[model samples]
Target: MTEEPARRRYDSLRRTAQAQQTSADIARAARTLFVAKGWAATTVRDVAREAGVSVPTIYAAYGNKNGLTWALTDAADLSADLSRLLAELESAPEPPRQLAAMVAYDRRLFERAGEVIVLLREAGRTEPELAQAYREARARADDAHRQVLSTWPPGALRSSIDLQTALDIYAAICNIDVYTELISERGWSSEQVEKWWCTMVIRELLEIPTAAT
Candidate 1:
């Protein structure tokens, strides 16, 4: 009887592992297709073929193209970097250090997920549902920005800059579009982009002026 129970448990574990592997393979295939064919042109069938799975598997796992894009975005997220940088920002004693931590996190994020970032941006432009979702996500980011800035020491921000304006400036300059333009289109290195991003954010949002100015 014990042997039978052990066999059942092993089978269950194997099935679970296989399912996880299938999901990962599907996600990888979807990402490759999305990048190569662009979001609008890539289909579930294409991904299924690439992953050696069926169309039903893709639908069951990810629902639709939008779902796959979301999954890809989640997979590409560098949560470890975010946590480390958030901790670094919190412990930072001064505004410059805090800003550096924030910028560093953004740099890491864009560098690792530049293609996904571009994919999402393009998808949002053409897909109404995703465009709404993207707007909502940006709204959440605004809230997060407010919370982070609230912890900063007095006089860290420019006297003329309000919370809303500060968030807008950050969004405009540190966003994926600008990153794509600089890094992908203009052939700028990741290091160059990070340095330029840091300079722009410091000059636009903070009281301290960048050396370039």
Candidate 2:
């Protein structure tokens, strides 16, 4: 009886491993399709064909194209990277320094997030599921900012800038779309853009004097 139970357990572990491998393959294929055809134009069948698997296999592994895309998003490490940055913000010694660190982190995130950004923009037009995921991610980031603000020392600084304004400025400075538009589209250098934006945000929203300028 014990041997039978052990065999069953081993079989279950093997099946779970196979399923995870299939899901990973599907996600990789979906990312390729997304990049080649854009998220709106890519279909589950396209991903299945690209992956050299049956459509049912893709669906069974990922539930749907959106699920596959979500998996791809996870693979990209965007959320994990952002979460780490947020944690860094929480641990930084001072608010102004934390804000500077946050801006720098945003720049790094944008550099690494080009493909995910493209997918997100495409999703905004035709994929409700992706758009919803994007919004939820933004909301989580916003919540993190709010929690950070809650630790601010009570004073005129806290009184002058409400949490909402601080969150909005943080969101604007951290927004990849805005960064792309200003830096990539407008030909502003990353350093120039971040410094200027960070200065303005710190001054206006947080009433914090930038150390150097």
* TM-score between model 2 and native: 0.66
Instruction: Give the CA lDDT, 0 to 100, for residue 25 in model 2.
Output: 65
What is candidate 2's lDDT per residue for 73-134, written digit by digit as tens?
54344422544554455446366766776676667657665567567666767778788766
> What are the lDDT scores of the predictions, listed in order?
0.67, 0.64
In model 1, what are the clashing residue pairs, if there are any?
A: none
* Angstrom error at residue 49, model 2: 11
lDDT of 1 at 58: 86
Q: Model 1's lDDT to the true fold?
A: 0.67
